[model samples]
Target chain A: MREQGRGDRLTALLRRGPLLAVLVLYTLYTTLPFLWVGAMSLRTTAEISADHYGLPSPAHWGKFRAAWVDSNFAGYFWNSTVVVVSAVAIVTVLGAMAAHALARYRFPGNRLIYFVLFSSIIFPPQIVLLSLFQILVNYDLYNTRTGLVLVYVSLQLPLTVFILEAFFARIPQDLFEAARIDGYTDFQIFLRIVVPVGMPAIVTTVILNFVHLWNEYLFAVVLVSDEDLRTLPVGIQRFMGDYFQDIGMIATGVMIAVIPVIVVYAFFSEKLIQGMTAGAVK
Target chain B: MSAPADAARLPAAAAPRRWWPAARRGERDPGAPSWLTLMAFLAPALLLYAGLTAYPVVRTFADSLYDLENMDAPRFVGLAHFVAIWSDETFLRAIRNTLVWSFVAPFLDVATGLLLALCLYAGVPFARFLRIAWFTPVLLSYVVVSILWLWIYNYDWGALNLALRALGLDGWARAWLGESSTALAALMVTHAWKWAGFNMVVCLAALHALPSEVLEAAELDHCGWAAKLRHIIIPMMRPTLLNLYILAFIGKMKVFDLVWIMTQGGPMWSTETVSTYVYKRAFAWNTFDLGYPSAIAVVWFIIVLAAAAVLHLAFRQREKLEY
Candidate 1:
């Protein structure tokens, strides 16, 4: 019996050994492209496709500066920043309010409204891009920051509300009852108490929305015609033409888009994981 | 300092009213103030949603019904554009390409991700470092990943070909993205490389939540590794696995950036997806059969809706198991 038990233990270890090795190897494989991109960003155009796969010798740091200035990436970066910030702010506020009302009040058409909003989360943006471009053209908001911000806010509202509602429902109702008895109005209670308590969810919503709006290419490419109005994703696409190539600059543009998200994730990874898992275990 | 104590003191020794309009509690009536507060929070979002998202979706269907670009006047085309797209060869090809994309990519990604997650979760050394490394690609913009992969797929100077030749597999080092048969497959693999970490992280989270006792029991029973996983681990992880599968399916159907960057429906439109085909028709081809792509979009929307509904029903019926 003891011999059989030992054999089983040995077999288990053997089975797990390859899996552990393969997983670590695959993880390195996954990070390789990102490291390559960052390396390319620092390499000159000439050495980008050269024999060296690891590092560039002279370390051409000017590509980042060149990509920033020569490509007018500064303007694109600012454009993305404004649109994303405004969209995230609006979505966070509106979504919180909608979630509060949905979770707290018993109103007619409440379930129906919830269902509609939830369904909207699944609606693909491609279905509406054509009409959206036309409408923006008609309203004279086409190619403008305000137009892009508006589109982003509308697109993200459903998801914001969905996650926020789930978070709100978990907050104890006794807190609300006590606030009401303290002579605080419903609006005040939500603004003062609920909002403060729900800061983590709001932060997660902001970071995710920020990442999304920064990297949005489809709308920026299609709706905006003027070069000055381009966002980073669209701006980077300009590097690729029929044949003439500059891989380093393109990689630099990608790095610019990437750094912000990495920084935010580094600071707020806990909130991101909470938002993603949505208290699944809890 | 002592904020919780102060808040705790506020509600005691008061007769709780069943219902109080603002004045019954110690505060002044916030009649107009409350309304303004609600509107303040709601107006910007409502205006944006109504004007941009909701209006555009409605207008897409409306635009599909009209022929508006003619010099003379706009005419009602009804569903002719939609009908025409059914027979449109490029549209058909795009549909076929998207079908392959949605079906194949998601399965491969989910399978690889699950395997990787199981491996990483085995209490291996440097496991946390491996987790971070694997998740790195998901942080980059799709444009960057696409660009890098494009270079990697180059015929002569690409790293992939170079590596193949170094391994003495010179005959196998063909232009991966140049051929019609392999172009879509290459793009799929690139996407899998980018997103597999995301799925792995998700699955790993679920794995981390499982109870240790079940595995211990299997071990005590002298069950070998395969039986333990099949009988204990896999059955326990069904719900999370299902959710990831559906999410992957929906995501793959909307695959755009990688395909656009790598091939651009290239060689001869062999790699075209519904999204690229839609863009081409609306902007590139300029036939303004806006209805055709809209119909395709509508179909895509319906598939998503159906999938969500099925998933919802499944979740409702699933018995909750304790960790």
Candidate 2:
């Protein structure tokens, strides 16, 4: 029995050897750049230039402070927070309302509305870029935070509704029926019952949308050319362009942008995965 | 409770009364809410979607037929911009590059994702930790990702070249993003890195959804790993693979951020794509001709729709295997 067990162990090792190696290599490939960035952010530009791959010696933690103060990341960060928060809040409430109606109500143009909204997923935003710009300008909303918020909400509405629809459908109809029997109106039942039950879906959409809107660059770049209105992504792009030579400062700026997302992912990685893959997998 | 008198008193309300709770009436569940209530529920979303998304899309189609400049009235110029795009060198280059990206990026991403998912499915050591680590990039914004890779791909003091020089292979290292020959490929590598993990998570989910008994059956049949993968696992994974492929294809076709931040279609327009070119024509360039960019967008949209339709039909023809 002992001899056979030893032999089995050897065979298993041989079987898993190449697979293990590939996994390790791939993990390193994905992670090493992040590590390098962290290390580079702590070192001076001269130190980085001297030994690009070396770890920071006596890490210059002040680089982040400098990046925040000098590069205007703080202002950009504030703008991103405001825009993402407002957009996500509106998207969640509005998306839930629409999703609830679609999932529960049988009305005229229901299927048509759902199909129209769903099909819009395949239409990339670039298709509407020219006209969207024109419309935003004509509405006297160009270069305004409110304009960006409106665009962000509209852009994310489809996915938010899509995710919420699935979750809302899974909700037990009996609860709503029971509420209705208790003299609760549709609006009241939706506000009181549907919103509470749909919290998980709402949270998922919020995190996902937050990540997307916060990172949104294309629209932010095109629609808002004013420096005061720049979001984090655009701000960082411009910072990188100006400070191309200052690798440490650039890395510091990137870390500021990246850390929140990493923290969110760490806390809610499963929800994040489920939310993102919900459309494709289904 | 007097039916004849009530019906006579409210003849116009008869249809609505019957349709109000349509499900209990032995017909379709027209849902429980009244039309007015349902419309109230839908109004906020409908207004936003229509005013912003739907209207703009329709307007883009209309705008493509006009010759409009900044603050200028749109003059009808039916298909002129579209015809001119075919002869425009930069636009043609963008189209070519976009086509290349659409084909190459998806294949690489899906292929890499499948490999990683298969490894995880086979059960490697610390599989949970490795899965999370692999998925780290998916959480990062493209701007951060671009910055990370920018440092790595920097000509001097970048990790990539520094590592190459340290390995005594200095000849292989060059300005990765600056050269026309390598710019597109370099940009694609960044895209693949960011997205492969996302695809892996998707594929892993699909794999987990697969029945293990069938895999065991194949093993019991003395099928080798390769043979089992070919005859059993792959066939079962067809629907998922097709879905991932289509998603990846569409994503790549519309990809803008990485290229815009990393290369900006530079080094003589080597990495120009439909998305970037549309932006350039409409905004970045001083031309300010909305009509031309609208033309590009309309054409690109049609191509995307056609491609999606073809893929859908192609994938649909194959019989899905039921477990």
Candidate 3:
């Protein structure tokens, strides 16, 4: 019995050996680029050129400050924050209200509205790129943060509504009926009951939208041409163009643009994963 | 509806004469919110969606029919831009590159995702930490990911070339992004790197949701790991895999940011995609010819919609393996 048990252990180890090797290699492939970039951010330009793989001898923490202030990442960060925050707030509120109506009240055009919004998921933004720019210019809303916010809200509303609709549907109908019997108005019930109960889904959509709109590139690049009004992604692109040879400074900018998202992911990765995959799995 | 059901339950004597029409009984519930209230709730989202998304889409179709480059007075030239695109080499190349990206990137992403998910499902040590580390790239914006890879692909002191030189394989080192033959492949690598983690998380979720009973049954049958994976696990994972495929396909089909930032469809337009081509025609090019890009957009949209519909139909007919 002891000899057989030892043989079984050896076979099990042999079975798992290849799998373990693949996992380790993959983990390295996925993470090493990020680590290298982070390491490069801490080094001086000369140091990076001297040894790409070496650790920073004297860490230049001031590169971040220089990237933020000198390279105008501060302004871009502020712009991204403002646009993403306003758009997320509006999309959440509007999407919740719309989702509530669709999920609860069976009225004319209910399915049609839901289908329209849901189907919009397949419509690539490129389809509307040209006309959207034209329309923005015609309305004189071009190059403004408000315009960017409006565009982001409209673009993100469909997914927001789609995700929230599922969550709202799971809510028991008895709760709404009970609230109504207590003389609660329709809007009042929505505000009082739905909003609070649907907080988890709401938070999910908020995080998802914040990450997306904050990272949005094409619209920001096309619609807003002004240097001061550019969002983070476009700003980083423009900065790269100006400082093409400054590897350390560019790495610093990349870190500045990426760290917020990393922090958010670190804390709320499960929620992010759930929100992102919810549509696909369902 | 409840009233009719109640009437049905009552005795013959208690069954009252038909009050409301039977057909309309369940159509409207008195307790349900009023139409006006529903509209009020829906109006904001509807108006915004229409004004920004729906209307713009429709306007793009209309603009595609007219020569709108000379903005002062537009001439109606229906289908001319569409006709012209048939022979446009650059546009054709963009379409070809987009097709390559759509096919290649999604497959790599899903393949890597499935592999990682399977490893994690096997209960590897440090699985949780590896999952987080793998997902880190997905959190970074396309711009930031592009910058990181750009540094890695830098000619002078990039990590890749440096490693190659250190390994004494100096002849193999070359500019990854500056060469025409490797630009699109390099761009696809970056996309796969960033998105594989997302797909892995998705597949991991699906794998966890798989019923353990099925696996136990297979084990009792003395099925080896490979046989169990092939016969049971793969079939059970069909829906999730298909869904991920569709998502990844659409995402690759509409890819713009990575190519825009890294290559700008450069190295002699080797990496030009439908999206970048449309952008260049409408905005980047000096002429500002709106009609041509609109036509391209319309065509690309149809292609994407058709691909999605076909994939859905193909997968829809399959009998789901419920365990």
Candidate 4:
């Protein structure tokens, strides 16, 4: 009987073995494109074309350097940085203030304001694409970094305000009353009290807004026509148009665009995940 | 700054009892503040959002009435552009593609996400590691993700073809993104890859928050995996699924980057979505007909609104489930 039980256990193990192997294989299949891109980036066009199935040679090492210059990646990198950082900073400060008020205070039209912000999420971006472009051109803000920053801030404000408001609303009310008793002005209370307690939420908002702004392509493409003002996405288009056959360099350029996002994720992966998923679960 | 003082100056009785009855019961209401406090916090965001988002949206409607490129005296061509789009093959194709893109991609992505969440929830070995690995694609910009996949789908020396050849299935390999028939679907699959992690993360959070006892009870009742998921888990996850569906729908409708990167809505405009088609009309094709694009955009907006309304009504009666 013991031998029979052992045989049954062996069969179970055998059944599970293939399932486990398949899962591992599926995971690899999912990630193969990423790994392949990295490998292809390191290979020269000749190396990629010559073997068709062989490993990349050492001759492709300079492709990254060539992509950097040929793609005008430095300009793209700078433009993206300027627009994203500035938009994140501005939205963070403004969003915090709005969130604090909406959460803590009772005022006429407060519900109306909340609905306005919330409903902004429903406005399809394409609807505003033409008009925003026209308005920016009329103001002579089109094709400028400031114009892109404004669009980013507008695009990002609703989400940031929504998340931050939810966070600020959770702060213990006694803390505010205590600060009030201590004669701390509202600004002082916000600056010294709410800001400190809300650092986690703020950080999350900053990371999210940064990612959104950095990845923005529509506004960048529509508004900025000059090659000099192009952000990373637009810059990549220029690179692709200019070097349609240089797959190695185009891959290298793409890999460069992906690095910052990965680095940011590595540092704030936890908070970013929590913040994003929080809305869905609730 | 002076607003708080002004608020304080109001007669004490008029200000109402500021003491919290909830505090006496060891519960606190966080929304206890004077009007001044509210203004100090809320005004800045309202102003910015109004200036940037609300204003531009209203302006879009107004701009649709005029022909800006012609510098023609701001003539109002009410509904003419809308009428014209019905005859425009590009616009019609874009509408069809956008509908397919939004509906199909979201369904696949959400379903994939739900499956992944279930796998992780079952405590599959290396589950945590799988979560991180799957999420790497989400971190990549659409620019990079599209480029990487385009190579993998390349005809001659592509990864997919290479894999097929390795498995002695060379006859099955094809130019995934090059052909018009498969290009849209290929793009949709790439989109699913990029966002499946996002939806999975969302669903996983909800799944984790579900009452474990309920699941256990279902299991004890001889409920198999499929039955338990269908009867217990999915019913509980209805609201989340609806919200994510709306979000995914809107996102797919407005998709540009991956399509732009992979095929540029090309190979004879086969995959030209509404947003991309509008973009082409206004910019690439330089049609000088802003009204037409705006009309298409307005229709897109209406479809999104319809989706949101339907979802909202469907989920309206659900009990708020807290994590």
Candidate 5:
């Protein structure tokens, strides 16, 4: 019996060998850049320039302070939080309203409206970027944070409605009928029922929009020019471009931009993944 | 995905003249919103969307016909901008490069995701850890990813070259992003690397959603692993894989940030995508004329729509919904 058990264990381990190898190899491929950058962020410039692959002995931590204070990453980070939070708030509120209208109402042009709203998802937004630039300039909103915030709202609303409408579409008619019989107005029902029950999908869109707008570059780069107005992504890009020779500064700046995201992903990874892919898998 | 299903029914129901048949049947939809409530709900979003996205898109089509260069009064050069961009070197390179990147990178993304998902299902030593670790890159900004690779692709002491040299393959190590031959290819790898995990999560979800009874049936029938995968698992995952393929395909077609950050269409425009090319031309590259880039944008927009349609039909060939 002991000989038989030992033999079975050996073969089982052997059977899992190939799959294990591939799994480990791919994890390394995905994670090595992060580890490499984390290491680079800690090393001194002299050390990094001397050798690209050296462990930091002292792990000089001043670079992050320099990036945050001198490089004005703090300002950029604040801008991003404000813009993303504001835009997502509006997306949640207005998206719920519009999605409810489209999904529940069997009005003429309902499907037309839905299709038009979602078509932009597949259509490239770059086509209209030039015209948008022109519009911003014309209205004297060229470099305003308000202008950027408004643009984010519009840019994000289509997908917001798309995702929310699906959730709203499946809502039972009996619930609405019951609400109406109890003297609940449409606005009251939307506020009371649709918003609460559709919270899962709404949460999904919020995560998606936050991630997207936080990482957005094309619009931030094009729309805003003030150093103070720059978001995290645009700020980091400029830092990289201007300080290309300063390897330590570049890595630290990136870490500063990336660390919060890592923290969030660490805590809410299951929710984040489910939220991010909700449109696809759901 | 729900999106493809919605799009599939678009044609059958698009006629706007008829009121909803349910409404025309004279039955009151108690749940149906009144006109005032409906307008209040939709007007805000529609108004914002109209002033921003729809108007700008229409203006771009209109702007493409004329020379909207600088502050000068606009010159109407009908289709001349279109004619010029087609003949221009950078735009042509951008067209070809974008096309290849759109197809190749997405294919790799879906393929990699599928393999990773399969590995998880087959059971690994630390499956949970691998699942989370693999998706970390997707959270990083393209600028961060681009800069990280810049260090990695450093000609002298980058990790890749160091490893190659360690393995006695010194001759094989070269500048990955600096040279024209490898710049676009290098960018594609970064894109697929970031997005592969997304597809993995989606594919993994589908895998778990697969019914266990079928696998049990296969097990009872004494089906081998390879045969089970070939005849049952992969076939069942067809809809999911195809949906991911199309999603990734559209993503790459809109590829800008990665290429813009990594190479900035560098080394003689080797990595130029249509989006980046248009950005430089219309904003940075001396020409303030909206006409030329607008023409390129317009054409590329149509091409994207057409390519998506073709892929949808091709992948949808002889397919049935497994669910």
Candidate 6:
């Protein structure tokens, strides 16, 4: 009761006032650009340029249609989905297998392999741009969506293994022993026990790898040169120069590109946050 | 890239082991698979990783030694490419720009994160909504972030200038991505905006895991909030903070897309990072000779490794908090 006295209450308010204000401001800072873009997408370019920063009165659906059909954003969307899905599927399996080996075994070079994979996270992917370009061209995999998928798989495998292996290592050893008595092979154990038990982590990896490879641009830009094969980010950038003044159209394009990833995050925000901060936390 | 297990940092011999990837303790046993089975599990990932990452690392270093500029069979020039870039004025400028970013961006990002984390930990209103809203930017592609900010930074009708003019700070308005002076710092602001939420999540986790008994004791002893943060919370979360700082540092060092999309390292190469420089040299410079870019990358690579090692060493020997 004494703590709630008017003088004490005022002091408490004074102590917390600035922090509350700052938090609100920062929330706006983070959310405003998104709001601005969404608002811009629904309004006309003339209205936007004239500084009529009101609500999207008389919202228009024309830009979305134009972006999808005429701007070839539909093509970019399909290409991104195919590349990301294929890469995520491949990397999940390969990464799960590698993580399974590293977690469940005591081979001679076990730690060696783990560190080698783990350390690649620090190597800037740009360092590989030149050599990988030469390799892809030499192998005739250049400018192909399948080729882009391979590069995405390799680029994303390190983080996938990092998260999954940690999750897998904590699986109780008794599961394997029980399976062994039942005459299950290692591969079968992986399929029946590890895969089933590790689904949360596997799903976490799938969500993370999907988000990562979906937005992957540098490799896709370098590896795929054909217009039809270009991913969403690259395709958007190429066409962005053409409609440089069409702010509403540009906003519409941004919405089309980001809305799906945002939907995915809306469903699994916890896992996305966890996977992004994979090594920093427990 | 490695966050050593907190338990791994507890003992006295925690120096080198702290750099090792976190793995299980005492998990090995009769359950260990044979080498053949192990390879069966590991081969596909390793082979792909080797071809794309490991092989390229070695090949980049090797190609840097040759004169591969003209598409002829390689000529082994042996260190000349490295020597050449060191003397090249624009390359040196790129290094300076990158180093400057490596320091400034991470500090801004982590500082913003620390502020947000503290607020969230203190149970700020609508904390769940705030956290989600804050992190939405992290999910955006660089192309999207870049274009959105480009519009905002436009000279005539961008929101920033509009707001500044509304506030009657009319003289403060200028082309953000156009200036040679403010260009790099402006881009760094976007980088912070996009990534500070990530650091916030990490710091929030660290904060949540701190021993509440110690905080209760601090309250019992009537420690001021500022004093408590300074003398207790920060000291306890030192490792996580350092981890975030290092990660952000390395990220800015390797940054490319923001610069490429926003400015193309323009306004006289003001925002040119090592990554964009290497890209332009190898691809856009029309030399078609990757050797020079490879050399630049190798040098920057070594610089990055050295910076990481030094940071790791400087933050070494922090007493593992046991509260």
- Measured on C-alpha atoms, candidate 2 has an lDDT of 0.82
Per-candidate Cα lDDT values, in order, are: 0.71, 0.82, 0.83, 0.75, 0.82, 0.83
The window of 10 residues in a row where model 6 chain A has the poorest summed lDDT is A273-282
Interface RMSD (Å) of candidate 6: 6.0
Question: What's the chain B TM-score of candidate 1?
Answer: 0.82
For candidate 4, write residues B1-323 as lDDT tens digits: 34334333422111001110111122233446666666667777777677777787777777666655664566678878778878998888878888888877888988888888887887778987787777777666787777778878988888778889989998989998878989888898889988888888878877997999999999899999889999999988876786788778877867888887788887778898877887887888867877767777787788787876776655554535432
lDDT of 6 by residue, A1-282 (tens): 775798898998898899989987888888788888888888888887776366788888887898899989999999999999999999999999998888888878888888878777778776787899888888889888877888889988987887777767767776677778889998898998778777767877787788777777788888888989889999888888787877778888889998898887899787787666656665
TM-score of 4: 0.89
lDDT of 1 by residue, A44-135 (tens): 77786565375867788887898788788898898888878888888888888887766565545556666667667667668778888777
| Candidate 6: stretches off by over 4 Å | A1-14, B1-20, B319-323
In model 4, how large is the Cα lDDT of residue A277?
A: 51
Alpha carbon lDDT at A143, candidate 1: 83
lDDT score for residue B319 of model 2: 42
Worst 10 residues of 5 chain B by lDDT: B13-22
TM-score of each predicted structure versus truth: 0.87, 0.92, 0.92, 0.89, 0.93, 0.93
List the pairs of residues colliding in candidate 6: none
Give one digit per residue, the lDDT tens place, for model 1 in B62-179. 7667765651365788887778767889878887888788767778887877777887776787877677667666666777778878878889878788889999999989898999
Q: Lowest summed-lDDT stretch of 10 residues in model 5 chain A?
A: A166-175
Q: Candidate 3: which docking quality band?
A: acceptable
TM-score-superior candidate, 3 or 5: 5
Instruction: Give the least accurate 10-residue stretch of model 2 chain A, judged by summed lDDT.
Output: A273-282
Q: After superposition, how far is residue B243 of candidate 6 from its true place, in Å?
A: 0.9
Predicted complex 5: CAPRI docking category: medium
Order the candidate numbers by TM-score, best to worst.
Answer: 5, 6, 3, 2, 4, 1
Q: Compared with the true structure, what per-residue lDDT tens digits does model 5 show for residues B1-21?
A: 243233233222111111111
| Candidate 1 lDDT for residue B35 | 51
